[model samples]
Target: MSAYMVGYARVSTNQQDLTAQRNQLNTLGVPEERIYTDHGLTGTNRDRPGLNQALAAVRDGDTLVITKLDRLARSLPDARDIIEELTKKNVKLSIGGSIHDPSDPVGRLLFNVLAMVAEFESDLIRARTREGMQVAKAKGRLRGKQPKLSKNQEAHVVSLYRGGQHTTAEIAELFGVARSTVYRIVQRTPTLN
Candidate 1:
């Protein structure tokens, strides 16, 4: 059977654009109906619905195309696994205008090298992020999400709990918060007046 081209596009965040990837697929002659997209989904996330659908729809002798290697997968292992599965099914993968044919020695080598580079890039990003966080923490600038309830609201929750007039659910409802939030407020050590 003649190989059919299937395209996949992805963007990590809602703010990131997918137009360029779509345009690339269009330039490759992939019909609009054959292109799948996962917007606001991270490459590291394996549960991309669009990717899954594209893979499922592809048959033997079909070519799966992506604008870039990272758009297909973030890590080496995931990329290798996808390639292996597709190879087993006689499907070809084309990334960034290069077709990675498993039957060709050079293509196989290139695919492996590129996959490792993508994984290394991801690891570097994580390491840099951790280093930045450590620096911020040392400067007392690293902080978690702001508390949902204000100090007065928390005090009111504690008081209501101490009075035994309201349950945790009641306190949560009264304060427009979750039951877990009410429990956390009550469990914390009270400040000395």
Candidate 2:
């Protein structure tokens, strides 16, 4: 049987457009029906429903196509794992138009080298980010996200919960915060020793 080309497109956030990737896949003659997508999902997350569906739909003599290497995987290990599965199924992985067949010696080497380079790049980025965060911390600038509720509001939330006057949901509704926020306030409150 001739190999069918299957395409996958992903975006990390809902605000990001998938149009560009879709256009590329369409240009490559991947039928609209065969293109799968994961919207507002991170590449590192393997639990993506769309990715699972695409992988499940591929047959032995099929080719899986992605617009970019990063779109398919976030880390080297993940890339290797996916490739290994495809190898077992005799499926070809196409990244940016470069086809890599796990059954081929040269393709295996090339794919490994590419995966290593991508891993190295990701590691460098993480290192740089850590260095930046450290510098910011030293400068008293890395305070992270601000608390959604004020101190008085949190105290009120605690009091309401302790008084058994309202449920966490009720407190959250009254305070205009999430039930999780109310739980945090309760957890952080000091207990009498």
Per-residue lDDT of 103-188 in model 2, one digit per residue for the tens? 89999888888877777777888899999999999999999999998899788788889989788889999988888888888999
Give the Å shift of residue 111 in candidate 2.
1.1
Off by over 4 Å in 2: 147-193
Distance (Å) between predicted and true CA of 164, model 2?
16
Q: Candidate 2, 119: how far from true, in Å?
A: 1.9
TM-score (C-alpha, index-matched) for candidate 2: 0.73
Q: Where does model 1 exceed 4 Å of error?
A: 149-153, 156-183, 190-193
* lDDT, candidate 1, 1-193, per-residue tens: 6778999999999999988999999898778899999999988998999999989878898889899898988988888788887877788888966788865678778888988898889899999999999999999899878898999888988988888998888889988999999888888947557
Q: Candidate 1: lDDT over CA atoms?
A: 0.87
User: How accurate locally, in lDDT, is each candidate?
Assistant: 0.87, 0.87
Q: How large an RMSD does model 1 have?
A: 3.3
Q: Each candidate's TM vs. the true structure? A: 0.78, 0.73
